[model samples]
Target: MVVKRLSALKRFLIGRPLKSNELGEQKLNKTKALAILSSDALSSVAYGPEQILIVLVTLSAAAFWYSIPIAVGVLVLLSALILSYRQIIFAYPHGGGAYVVSKENLGMNYGLVAGGSLLVDYILTVAVSVSAGTDAITSAFPSLHPYTVVIAIVFVLLITTLNLRGVTESASILAYPVYLFVLALFILIGVGIYNILTGHVSPELHTPVGTPVAGISLFLLLKAFASGSSALTGVEAISNAIPNFKDPAPNNASKTLMAMGTLLALLFTGIVFMAYYYGVAPQAKVTVVSQIAEQTFGRNFMYYFIQGTTALILILAANTGYSAFPLLAVNLAKDKFIPRMFTVRGDRLGYSNGIIILGVCSILLILVFKGQTEHLIPLYAVGVFIPFTLSQTGMIFKWVREKPSGWMPKLIINSIGALISLIVTIMFFLTKFAQVWPVLIFLPIIIYIFYRIKKHYLAVGDQLRLTTCEPAMPIEGNVIIVPVAGITHVVENSLNYAKSLNPHQVIAVYVPFERQEENDFEAKWMKWQPDVRLVTLYSPYRSIIQPLLKFVDTVQRKASESNYQVTVVIPQFIPKKGWHNILHNQSGLVIRTKLLYRRKVIVTTVPYHLTK
Candidate 1:
C-alpha cells in the first residue's frame, strides 16, 4: 500500500512513464533546443561583463573604459569556439563532445581528463547560474537578500524537477522565459543607445569613480579578459547534446549552435557596451545588468521586468547543465568509466540518476559558498576551459589525420582555438588559483577514479565471461536444512516446501537460549516430528544465526562427501501494516543477509502472511 502511494506521487511529479516508442517524440525541435541548450551562454551576459568590470575596477575607476577591448577579446574566443564546436557536431554527431573527440583522436588518458573537466564544469554551471539567478531576485527585492542560499537551492530543485519531466517537456516550459530575457536585454540596450545618442544620458554624469589601487598592467588586463571569457562557458553544450535534437539531429544541432552563438555575441557585446556607455560598475547588492536597467528605465515596470526575466533565464540556464551532464555521464558509463546505472533511463525517458546527482551536488556548492555567485565564479571557468583546450587540440589531431576537403581550414581554426583556450585556462588557474585550487586538485582525483572504475569493470567482465567455463551438470543429490524458531504454522509452511524439493535428507534445526528449553524443544520436535530429522543446539552466547550457521556447515561437509548440494529454507511472517514490521525480530532477514556470500549454499524464504 505504501509503495503504491509513493509510486502515485512519483507519477504526479514526473508525469506518466514514457514508453520506448515515445522516445523519438521527446526529441526537441531547433527552437526549443536553442532554449534548453543555450540558456547558459545567453544568460551569462548578465554577469560576464560585470565580472570583467570587477577586476578592472580594482585598478581604478578609469579602467572601466578597458571593458570594450576585453569584451572584444572574449567575443573572438567565442567565435573560435563556435566554429570549432560546429566541426565537432558534424564529425561526432552522436555527441559526447570533448570526451569523445579527445578519446578517439588523442588517447584514453586525455579523454578522461576532458571528461572529468566537463563533468566538473557542468556541476559548477548549475551552481553558478542558479546562484546568480538568486542574486537577480535579491537585487530586485533587497529584503530577500538574507535567504540567498535557500532561494538558490529552491531554484536548483525546481529546474531539476522540470528536467525530470523529460527533455521535450522541459524545453517547451523553459523556452519562453529565455525569449523574454532576450527581448528585455535588447530593449534595454536599444533604449540605452537611444538615450546616449540623443544626449539624454551622459557617461560623465553616471560613471563611477573609484580610488585607484594599482596601475594597469598586462596581468590585470589578462585577468579581466579571463573573467569575461566565462561568457563562452556553455558553447560546447550543443555539441555535447546533438542527439537531443529532432530528425536530422546533427544538422538541426548545428543550426541551434549557430543561432545560440549569434545571440550570445549580440547580447554579451550589447551588455558590455551599455555598461561602458552608462558608466555602470559592479555593486555589492545589485547586478550590473540590474543597474543598467534601472538607469535606462528608472525604477519602473521595465526595470522590474528586466530583473524578473533575468532571474528566470539565469535559473533556467541550468537547463543546459541538466541537458548535457546526463548525456555525458551516459557516454562515460557506456565506456565503463562510471557506474552503469547512469546509462538507464527513468520513467520519463530522462537520465534521472544523473539529473538528481547534479542537482544534489549543485545544492551542496550553494551551501558551501553560501549561494554567492562571485564566490563560485572563481571555480567556474577552469573546468570549462580545460575541456575547450583538449577538444580543440583533439580536433587539430583529427583534421591532420583525416585530412578531408578543407582540412587545412579546420586545422587552422582548431589550432587557434586550442592556443587561445590553453592561454585562458592558464590565466584562470594563475589568477584564481587561491579560490580554484580545489578544482585543480579535484580533476586529477576524478580522472584516477575513472581509471579505477574501468579497471573494476574489466575485472568483473573477466570473471563473468562464459567462454572459459565448463558446461553445467546436475548435482548427484540435494540436502535441505530448515531453521525454525518454534512449532508454528510458519515452520510448517517452510517444512512442506523443503519436502517438496525431494531432497536426499531434510533436517530442522533450532537454537535455544537455555539448555532446558533445548531439551524441551527436541522432545516436542520428536513427538510432532513429520518425516524430517530434528536437531537442537544450545547457543551459550544466545546468538541465533551463528549456531545455525555452524550446524549448516557441518551438514554441508557431510553432504559434500556424498556429492550432495545444500539448501536452507527459512520462514518469515509478513506483517499486515508497514509499521507492524517494527514489532518483529527480523531474524530471518538477518540470516538471509549473513548467508548470502556462503559458497555453494542455496537459501530460500517461505513467507506466511498475517491478517491482523
Candidate 2:
C-alpha cells in the first residue's frame, strides 16, 4: 500500500508514463526551448557583473572603471562562442556538446576532460544558481537570511522533480516566470536610464566605489574578466540539447543559441553600466543589482517586482543545468564512459537517475557552503572554462579539417575564441585557485572512476558470454529437499509442490535445538503419517544454517555419484500488511541467502501468501 501510494504520487506529479510514440510530442519549439535551455545564460546576468565588481572593488575606486572593458571582452567572447557553436550545430547536428566534439576530434582522453569539466560545472550551476536565487529572496526579506541553505535545497528539489516530468512540460511550466523576469528587468533598465537623464536619484543611490584599495594592474583587469565569465556558463546547454528541439532540431537549436547569447550580452552589459552609473557596490548581504533597482525604481511595486522576478528567473536558470546534465550523462553512458543507469528513461521519458543525482549533489553543495553565492561562483567559473576552452579548440580543428564553404573564416574565428578562452581558463585558475583547488583535486579522480566503471562493464559482459546454447550433459536423477522449521500449513504446501515436481524423492529436513523438541516433532510427524519422509538433525550449538549446510553437502555428495541433481525448496509466507513482516523473523530469507552459493544445488521458493 505504501508503494502504491508513492507510485500514485509520482504519477500525479510527473504525469503518466510516456509511450515511445509520445517522445515526438515532448520536443520543444523555439519559444519554449529558449526559456528552458537559455535560463542559465539569461539568469547569470543577475550576478555576473556583480562578481566583476566584487574583485575590482578590492583594488581601488578607479578599478571600477575597468568593468566596462571586462563586459566588452565578455560580450566579444560570447559572440565568438555563439558563432562557433552555430557551426557545431550544423556540422555535427546531433547535439554536439563539448564532450562529443572533443571525443570525436581530439580523442577519448580530451573527451573525458571535457565531460568531467561539464559534469562538475552543471552540478555547480545548480548550486550557484539556487544560492544566488535564494540571495535575491533574502535581499527583499532580510529576516529569511538564516534559511538560505534550506530554501536553496528545496528549490533544487523542486526543479529536479519538475524536470523529471519531461522536457516540454518543464519548459511550459517555467516559461512564464522567465518571460516576466525579462520584462521586469528591461523595465528597470528603461526607467533607470530615464532617471539618469533627468538628474533625479534616490537616497539609496549614493555609495562609494572603493576604499583602502590596491592599485589596478594589468593582471587585475584580466582577473576581472575571469570573474565576469559567469555570464557565459550556460551558453553551451543548447548545443548539448539539440535533439530536444522540434523538427529540424539543429536549426532550432542554433537559433535558440543565438537568441540566448544576444540577450545575455545585452543584460550583462546593461546591469554593469547601470551599477557603475549608480555607484552600486558589493554589500555585505544584498546584491548590487538590488541596489540599482531600489535606486532607480524606489521601494515601490516595481522595485519588489524586479526582485521577485530576479529570484524566480535565478531559480529557473537552474533548469538550464537540469536540461543539459542528464543529456550529457546519457551520451557518456551510451559510450560506456559512465554507468548505464544514467541512460534509463524514467516513466516521463526524462533521465530520472541523472536528474536525481544532480539534485542530491547540488543540495550537498548548498549545505556545505551554507548557500553563499560568492563562494560557489569561483567553483562554477573554473569548471565552465575548461569545457569552454576544449569545445572551441575542437571546433577550430573541425573547421580546419572539413574546409566547408567559408571554412577559413570560421576557423579563424574559432581560433581566436580558443585562444581567448584558454587565456581566461589559465587566468581564472591562477586568480581563483584557492577556491578551485578542490575541483582540480577531484577531476582526475572522477575520470578514473568512469574508467573503472567501463572496466567493470566489460568484465561483466565477458562473464555473461554464452559459448553454447544448451547444456553439455543432462541430469540422470533429481531430488527435492524442503527446508522446514516445524510442521505448519506453509511447509505442507511446499511439500505438496515438491511432490508434484516428479523428483526421485521428496524429503522434509529439520534442524532442532533440543533432543526433547526433536522427539516431540518426530511424534507429531508419525501421528500425521504424511506421504513425505521426515529427516531430523540435532544442533547443540543452536546454529540452524551450519547444520543445514552439512546435511545438504552430504546429500549432494551421495547424489553426485549417481549423476543426480539436488533442489532445495523453501516455503515462504508473505503477509498482506507491510507491518506484519516486522512481526515475524525471516528465517526463510536466511536459508535462501545461505544456500544460493552452493554448487550443483538449485534453490526454489514456494510462497504461501496469507489472506489475513
Candidate 3:
C-alpha cells in the first residue's frame, strides 16, 4: 500500500505517462518518440557554437570569422553521420552500438576500446555541456561568476536524481522546456538574421570585433573546425538509447536522427550567420548570452527572457548526459567492464547507481573548475572526439562484416564519417595539447584499469568458487584490539565502539610516535571508561604499520591457545570535506591494512566524524 501510494505521488509530481499503461508499450508514433531523442541531440544548439567561438578567441578576429566554414563542415559531417547511424539502427535493431558492433565484427579488443572511448565521451559530454551552460549564465550575470560551476553541479545532481527516478518522468518534465528553448532560439535567430539582412540591425557586443590575423591560415581553420566539432558531440545519444523509443526502433531512430540533423544545421548556421552579420567576432570577451542579447535586444525584456531561456536550456542539457550516460554504463556493465550496480534499475526502471555516479563526477568537475566554462572548454573536446573517431571506425567495420543487402549506402556514408572524425580528432589533438592532453591520457588509463578490474573479477570468481561446504572454522575468542595513534575523539570512539560490540576482551594498543603522544594517551585514558585494557607498543623507527602488525600477530598467536577470535578496531577520523581527508589519517590506513591480513582476525573500522 505504501509503495503504491508513493508511486501515485511520484506520478502526480512528475506526470502521467504518455501511454495509458505505465509499463505497457509506448503509443507515441515515430515522430513523437523521435522528438524525445531528437531533443537530446538538438539541444546542443544552446552551447555548441558558443564552444566554437570561445576556442577561436585564442586567435585573431579574422581567424575567428573562419568559424563559419568550421560550423558548415561540422553540419555536413553531422548529416553524414546521422545517415550512417540510420544504417546502424537498421543493421543492429537489437541495439548494438560501437562496442557491440566492433566486438561482433572486428575483435574483442576493438570492442573494449570502443566501450572505453564511449564511456569517457559520455562523461565529457556532461561536463562540457553543463559547464557551457554555466558559462552562458555567468556571461549574463557577472555576480554568478564563481557560482556557475556550483549551480551547474547542483543541476547535474538534480537531473541525475530525476533520471534515476525514470526516463519517462524526466522526458515529460524536460521535453516541453527543451522544445520551448529551441523554438525561442529559432525565432530569435530567424528574426535577428532577417533584421540584419534587411539592414535594420545595430552592432553586437563585440561590434566590429577587430581581426588580428589577415587571411585564415590552415592552422586557424583547423582550430575553428575543432571548436565547432563540439556541436556534434551528442549525436550518438539517440543511437545509444534506441531501445527506449516506441515501436519500430529503426524507423524511430531514423526519424529522430533526421530531425536532429535538420535542427542542428539550422541552429549552427543561424547562430553563425547572426554573429557574422553583426561582426560578433568569435574571439571576443563578451562572455554571456546576455551580452550577446544586449547587443541585439538592447537591454529589454526580451534580453532577460533570452537569458532565462538559455539557462533553462543549459540546465536541461545536463539531462542529455543524465539519460545517456546511465545507458552507456548499463552497456559497459553488461559487458562486465563496469560494476553490476549500473545494470540495476530503480523501481521506476532507471539506472539509479549510474545516474548518481555521473552526477557526483560532474559535480566534482564543476567544483574543481569553479564553474568557469572557459577554462574547462579546452579539455572538453578531447574526451568527445576520442570516442567519436573510434565509434565511427567501429561502424565501418560493422558495415563490412554484416554486408547487408544494401550495404553500399552505409559503407560510403560511414566511410565519410570515419574519415572526417579521424581528421577532426587529429585537428583537436594538435589544437588542444597543453590543456586537453592530460585528460586524454588520464581517462584512457582509468578505463584500462577498469578493464583490468573486470578481468580480475572474472578470474577471482572462478578461483574462489567454494568446491564443497567445508566445516565452519572455529572462533579463534572475540578479542578486540583497539588501534590508537593519539587520544583524540577517534581513539575514544574506537574504544567505546569496540566495547559496544561486546567482544570477549578489548585491548587498546597504541603506537608511540613520540614520548608526548604516549603521555597524552595515558592522560586521556582515564577520562572515559572502556571495558578494554590499554597497551602501548614502542616504535623506534616511528613506523605505524610494522608495530600494529606485530601486535596483531601476537594476539593471533595467543588466540590459538584458547579458541578465541581477534577483532582489530582501527580508529579513523572521517573528514567532512575532501581537503581535510588529504591531511588527516595517513597512519590509520596503513595500520588497517596490516591488521586485515592476519590469519584469524576480523577488522572493524570505527570512524569518528571530524570537522575540517
Candidate 4:
C-alpha cells in the first residue's frame, strides 16, 4: 500500500511514464532544442560581459574600453568553435562528443580526460548559472540577498525536476523563458544603441575618472579574455547531445549550433558594447546588464522585465547541463567508465540518475561556495577549455587519419580551434592559478576513478562471461537445515517446505539462551515426535545468530566434502501492519546478509502471514 502511494506520487510529480515507442516523439525540434541545449551559451550574456570588465576594472577606469577588443576576441574564438563543432556533429553523429572523438582517435586515457573535464564543467555550469541567476534576483530585490544559497539550490532542483519530467516536456516549458530573455536583451541593446547614437544619452555622463592602479599589459588582456571565455562554455553541448535532436539528428543539431552561436555572438557583442559605452563597472550586487537596462530604461517596466527574464534564462541555463550531462554520462556508462545505473532511463525515458546526481553535486557546490558566482567562475572555464582543446585536437587526428573528402579545410578549422583553446587553457591556469588549481587537482582524481571503474567492469565481464565456461551438472546430494526460534506454525511451515525439497536429510537447529528453555523446547519436540531430527545448541552469552551461523557453516563444510549442496531454510512471520515490523527481531535478514557470500550454501525463507 505504501509502495502504491509512493508510485502514485512519483507519477504526479514527473507525469505518466511514456512507452518505449514514444521515445522518438520526445526528440526535440530546433526551437525547443535551442531552449534546452543552447540556453547556457545564450544566457552567458547575462554575466560573460561582466566577467571581462571584472578583470579590466582592476587596471583603471580607462581599462573598461578594452572590453570591446576582448569581446571581439571571444567572438572570433566562438566562430572557430562553432565551425569545428559543426564538423564534429557531421563526423560523429552518435554524439559522445569529445569523449568519442578522443577515444577513437587519441586513445582511452585521453578520452577519459575529456569526459571527466566535461562532466566537471557541466556540474559547474549548473552551480554558476543558478548562482548567477540568484544574483540577478538579489540585485532586483535586496531582501533576498540573505537567501542566495537557498534560492540557487531551489533553482537547481527546479531545473532537475523539469528535466526528469522528460526532454520534450522540459523543452516546452523552458522554451519561452529563453526566447523572452533574447527578446528583452535585443530590445535593451537596440534602445541603448539608438540612445547613444543620437544625442539623447551621453557616454561621458556615466564614464568615471580615476587614477590607473595597474597598467594594461598583454597578460591582463589575456586574463580578461580567459574570464570572458566562459561565454563559450556551452558551445560544445550541441555536439554532445546530437542524439537528442529530431530525425536527421545531425542536420538538426548543426542548425541549432549555428543558431546558438549567432545569437550568442550578437547578444554578447551588444551587451559588452553597451557596457563600454555606458561606462558601467561591476557593482557588488548589481549586474552589468541590469545597469545597462536601468541607464537606458530608468527602472521602468522594461527594466524589471529585463531583470526578470535575465534571471529566468540564467536559471534555465542549467537546462543545458541537464540535457548534456545525462547523455554524456550515458555514453560513459555504456563504455563502462561510470556506473551502469546512469545508463538506465527512468519511467519518463530520461536519465534520472544522472540528472539527480548532477543536481546533488551542484547543490553541494552552491552550499560550499555560498552561492557566489565569482568563487565558481574560476573553476568553470578551465574545465570546459581542457575538453575544448582535447576535442579539437581529436578532430585533427580524425582528419589526418581518416582523410575523408574535404578533410583539409575541416582539419584547418579544428586546428585553429585546438590552438586557441589550448592557449586559453594555459592562460586560465596562469592567470587564475590561485582559484583554478582545485580543478587541476580534481581532474586527475576523476580520471583515476574512471579507470578504476573500467577495471571493475572488465573484471565483472570476465567473471560473468559464458562463452568459455563449462556446462552445469546436477547435484549429487542435498542436505537441508531449518533454523527455528520456537516450535510454532511458522516453523512447521518451514519444515513442510524443507520436506518437499526431497533432501538426503532435514535437520532443524535451534539456539537457546537458557538451559531451562532448551530443556522445555526439547521436551516439546519429543512429545510432538515430528519425525524430523531436532538439535539444540546452548548459547552461553545469549547470542542467537552467532551459534546458528557456526552450525550452518559446519553443516555446509561437511556437505561440500560429501559432494552435496546445503540449503538453509529460515522461517519469518510478516506482520499485518507496516509499523509492526519493529515489534520483531530481524534475525532472518541478518543471517541472509551474513551468509550471502558463502559458496555452495543456499538460503531460502518461508513466510507465514500474521492475522493480528
Candidate 5:
C-alpha cells in the first residue's frame, strides 16, 4: 500500500507513464519548439549587450560607442552559424548535431572532441543561465542578493523537475514565459527607439561604474566581441533537437530555427541599439537591460513586468541545454563512446538520468561560483565556439564530399562560418585565459574520459561475444553442492531446492570454526535431514569462503574428469527491513565474490525472505 501510494504521488506529480509508442505523440509543434529551444537565444539579448559594455567600459566611458559595431559583428557571426546549421538540419535529420557531423566526417577522435566540447558547453549553459536569471531577480529585490546562490540552485532543481515530465510538457510550461519576455522586449525596443529619435532618453545613473582599462587595443575589442558572443550559446539547440519535433520534423525544426535566428537577430539588434542610444553602461547595482527597461517603461508596472519575464526566460533558457544534452549523450552512447544507460528513456519518455545529472552538475557550479553571472559568462562563452567551429567544418566536409545539387553555396557559407568560429574560439581563449583555464583543462580530461569509456565498452563487448556452435550436451554425472553454515530452515530450504535439481549426487559441505560448533551442527543435521549426504572441512584460518571455495573446486575438478556437472547453491537471508540486514553476516556474498571469475564453478543463490 505504501509503495502504491508513493507511485500514485509520483505519477500525479510527473504524470502517468507513457508507452514507448507515445514518444512521438509528445513532440512539440514549431511554436512550442521555438519557445522551449529558442529561449536561450532570445533571453541572451538580456545579457549579451551588457557583456560587451562590461568589457568596453573597462577602457573608457566612451567605449560604449563600440557596442553597436561589436553587436553587428556578433550578429553577422550569428547569421553564418544559422546558415551552416540549416544545412545540418536537412542532412542529419536524426539529430546528432555536431557530435554526429564530426564523428561521421572528421573521424571518431575528432568527433569525440566535438562531443566533449558540447557536453561542457551544455553544462555551463545551465549554470550561467540560472545564475543570470537569479541576478535579474536580485536586481529587482536587492535584499535577496545574499541568497543568490541558493536561489540559483533551487531554480535549477525546478527546471530539472519540470523537464523530467517530458519535453513537450516542459515546452508548454516554458512557452508562455518566453513569449511574454519576447513581447515585453519588443515593446521596450519600439518605445525606446521612438524615445531615442525624439531625444527624450533617460540620463545615465548619477553614480556611474568605475572605468578600469586605460586604452582600447585591438585585443580589447576582440575580447568584447567574444564576450558578446554569449548571444550565440543556444543557436544549435534546435539543430540538436530535430527529433523532438512533430511530423516533417526536420522541416518544422529548420523553419523554427530560422524563426529563432530572425527573432534573436532583431531583439539583440534592438537591445544593443537602445542601450547605446540611452548611453547605458554596466553599473554596480543595476543591469544594462534593467536600465534600458526603466528608461523605456519608466519604473511603471510594465517595467517590473519586464524584469519578471526576463527572470523567467533566463531560467527557462537552461531548458535549451536540458533538451539537447541528453539527446547528444544518447548519440554518443549509441556510438559506444559513453555508457549505454543514457540511451534508455525513462517513464516519462525523457532522459531522466541525464536531466538529473545536468541539474546536479549545474547546482555544484552555482555553488562553486557563488551564483555570480559575470564570473561564469567567460567560462561558457569559450565552450560554445568549440562545437560551433567543429560542426561548421564538418558540414563543409559533408558538402564537399557529397557535391549534391547547389552544395557549393552551402560550402562557401560553412567555410566562412568555420573560419569565423575558429577565430572567435582562439580570440576568446586568449582574451580570457585566466577565466577559461578551468574549462580548457577540463576539455582534454573530458576527451580522455570519452576515449576511456569507449575502450572499456569495446573490451566488454569482446569479452561478452558469443561463439556459434552446437551446445554442449548435459554431462552424465551431475553434482549439486550446498554451502551449509549450520542446520537451519534457510539451509534446509536451499538443500531441498538442490535435491530438486535431480542431480546424480547431492552433497552439503560445512566449514567448521570450532570443534564444538561443528559437532553440534553435524549432529543436528543428521537428526533433521530428510535425505542428503554430508561433508565437513576444517579451516585453520577461520575463513569460511576460502575453504568452501577449495572444496567446490575439488568437487568440480573431480566431476569434470568424469564429464560431470556441478552447481553450488548458496543460501541468503534477505531481511524485510533494510536495517535488519546488519544483524547477520553476509557469508553468501563473500563466497560469491570469491568464485565470481571461476568459470568451472556454477553458483546459484536461494534467497530466504525474512518477514520479521
Candidate 6:
C-alpha cells in the first residue's frame, strides 16, 4: 500500500493516475457538477458589463449609459449562443470541445489554431477574472490593493497545486466555493431586485464623475460588443469539461449548458438592472458594480461582503481556465499537433505540466495589466471570438459535408448559428485589432512551430520504418574500445571490467591534448596491461569530438571486415550535486550518439557515482 502511494506520487508529478474516477467515487450527481460548471460561467456577471463600460467610456456621455442596453443585447445574444451549443453538446459530448468540433469538420490545422486561441482565452479568463475579484476584495479593504497581484498569484498557485493533485480533488475543492458564489449572487440579486420592484427603491448613484460619453458611433458599439462577449467566455468550458461528468455524459452536458445559460441570464439581468436602478454607469473612473454596492450599503459590512465574494469568485474564475486548458492540450496532443509530453498525465493524473505552463502565462498576463480587468479587456475578447469563429465555421462545414436531406431543422439552425457567430467573431477582430492584434499575430507563429514539430516527429517515424531483417551472422572476433580522458578510478574500473568480458582482443583508445600533463595514465596502462593494445590519437586543435569519432570509425571498419563484435565501454561519473553537472564533465551524450550508428557494436556506460 505504501509503495502504491509512493508510485502514485511519482506518477502525479509526471502526469498519470487520473483522478476523474476519484471524483466519481464521491458520487457527485450530474446536477452537482452541472451546478459547478454553471456557477463558474455565471460568476462573470460581476464584471462582464463592467468590461463593456470600460471601453465605451472612451466615447461620449450617452455611450456611458448605453452600457445598459448593450448589456441587455449581449445577455440575449449569449443566451441564444448557449442554446446553439446545446446541439453541439448532444452531438459530440464525448469531450469534443471546440477543438474537436473544428478538427472533425474543418481539419487538424484549424483545430490546432482554434485550440491555441481558446487556450489563451481561458488563461486570460483565469487571470482577468481573478484579478478583478482581487480588485473587488481590495475595494472592501483598501489595505490589500498594494498586494493585489501577490494575492492573485497566490490564488493561481493554489488552484494549480490542487489541480495537479488530481481533477477529482480539484473539483471537490472548488464545488463549495462555486456553490457559495451562486448562493451569494441569488441572495444579493434577489433582494436587490425586490428592493427595485418595490417603491422602497432608494435613489443611489456614485458621487458623479465627469460628464459621461454621449452620441456613441458604430465603432463604439462594436467595441462594446467585443467587451460584452467576455460574459460568454466560459460557456465553452462546459464542452471541455464534459468528460468529467458522470455517465450519460451528453445528457449531463446539455443539461449543464441549459442550467448555466438560465442561471447566467438571470444573474446578469439582476446585476445590470440593479446597477441601472442605482444609477451607476460603468466608466473607466467608476466601474458600475462597485458603485452599486457602495450605493446599496455604503462602505459598511454588506458592501464588504459583496466585495469579498467578488474577490473569491475572481480567484475561482481561474479554476474554469485550469480545468479547460488541460483538456484542450490533450486534444491538441492527440491530434499530434503539439508536444507528446502534453499527452501524458502526471502523478495526480492531471496534466500538471500543461497546468503549470498555463498558470505561468496567466501570471504574466496579470502582471502586464497590473491586475486591471479594464486594461486587459480588449485583448480578452479577441482570443475567445477567434475560437468561436473557427468552431462555428467548422460546424458549417460539418453540416455541409454531411448533406443531410431530411434534417433541414438541424441544417437551418446550424447555418444561422454559424453565420451569427462568424459575424460576431469578425466584428470583434475588426474593433479589437489595435488592442489585441499583437496576440493574434503571436499565436499563429506558435501554432505553426507546433505544426513543424509534428512534421519532424512524423518524418523521423517514416525514416525508422523497417523493411526486412538482416540474416544472422556468427561473430568471428571481439574488440573492446575504452575511451579515456585520464585514467581515473572510473576509467580503470571500466577498463578492468571490459578486460574481464574476455573479448577476442581489448584496446584502449585515448584522445591526446597538447595541454594535458596526463602522460602517467598511458604509462600506467602500459605497465599494468603490457599484453593489451593501447592506441592514442592526436588532436592538434584540442578538438576532441572529431578525432575520437574518426578513430572509432576506423576501428569499426576493421571490425566489420573481420566480422568482429566490438564493445565500447565509456566511463561516466554521475555528480552528487546538480550544479556541478556542467562544470565537472561533458561529452557523455556526444560520444554515445556517435557510437549508436555503428552496427554489431555495443556501447555501455560504466557510471561512477560521485560521493560528497
Estimate, for each residue in 1-612, the C-alpha lDDT of model 6 and write its tens digit: 455776776566444454555545532345666544654476678888676766665664345556667777787667656766776787677775788888888887788778878878878887887777787777666787789889888887777777676666666667776667767677777777776678556644422333344565777776676677677778878877777777777787788788788878887877766765665566433446667777666777766666666667767777778777887888777767777788776656567778888889989988887888766756776677667677766766776778666555666666665665666677766776677777768787978887898898888777676654345678886788888877588877887788888644778877777524446656777787677677877777887778877887788888888888778888898777766777865787788888788766688998888897
How far off is residue 166 in model 6, in Å?
1.3
lDDT of each prediction vs. the true structure? 0.91, 0.87, 0.69, 0.90, 0.86, 0.72
Instruction: Write the residue-wise lDDT of candidate 3 on 327-364 in tens digits.
Output: 77787788788888898866666666887788787777
Ranking by TM-score: 1, 4, 2, 5, 6, 3
For candidate 2, write residues 1-612 as lDDT tens digits: 887998899888888998978889989999999999898888999999998998888865456767877888998889988888887888777774999989988888889999998988899999988899999999999999989988998899899989989998899989999989888888888887788788775524433444233576788888999899878889889999998999899989988889888788778878998887787788878888899999887899988999999999999899988899999999889888898999998898888999999999999989889999898888898788888889888887787777788789888878888888899888878898888888778889989988998888887877667753334457887888898887789988998899889534987888889999999998898777466788988999998888888899899999889888899999999998888999998988998998999968999999999998
Model 5: per-residue lDDT, tens digit, 1-612? 455778898887788889999988889999999999998888888899998988888876667778777888998999999988998999999998988999898888778888888887888889999988988998888999898988998899889989999998888889999999999998889988788667686545221233333576888888889889988889999989998999899999999999999999999999888887678879866888898898788888989999999999998899999999999998988888778888889999999888888898898888889988888888788788888899999988888898999989999999999998998889877988888888768878988888898889888777666764345666786799898887788987898798888644889999888888788878888788847888888777798887887888888888898888888889987887766767889878888887877887788899998787
Model 2 local distance difference test score: 0.87
Prediction 4 TM-score vs. true? 0.96
Error of 1 at 80 (Å): 0.2
Worst 10 residues of 2 by lDDT: 203-212
lDDT of 1 by residue, 1-612 (tens): 888998898888899998998999999999999999999999999999999999988976777878888888998899899999999999999999999999999999999999998998899999999999999999999999999998899999889998899999999899999999999999999998899899988758534444244587899989999999988889999999988989899999999999999999999999998888788878999999999999899999999999999999999999999999999999999999999999999999999999999999999988988998898887888889888999999999998888899899889889989999999989988899998899868888998899899999998897777975455546898988899999999999988889889733888889999999988888888888756888888888999988899888888888778878889998998998788899889889999998888887899999999998
The digit string of per-residue lDDT tens for model 4 on 474-531 reads: 6788899998888799999988999899634999898888899999999999877468
User: What shift in Å separates residue 230 of candidate 1 from its native position after superposition?
Assistant: 1.2
Q: How far is candidate 6 from the true structure (C-alpha RMSD, Å)?
A: 4.4
Candidate 4 RMSD computed on C-alpha atoms after optimal superposition onto the true structure? 2.2
Q: Candidate 3: which pairs clash?
A: 57-283, 139-288, 149-371, 476-564, 476-565, 477-564, 477-565
Poorest 10 consecutive residues by lDDT, candidate 1: 205-214
Which ten-residue region of model 4 has the weakest summed lDDT? 205-214
lDDT assessment of candidate 6: 0.72
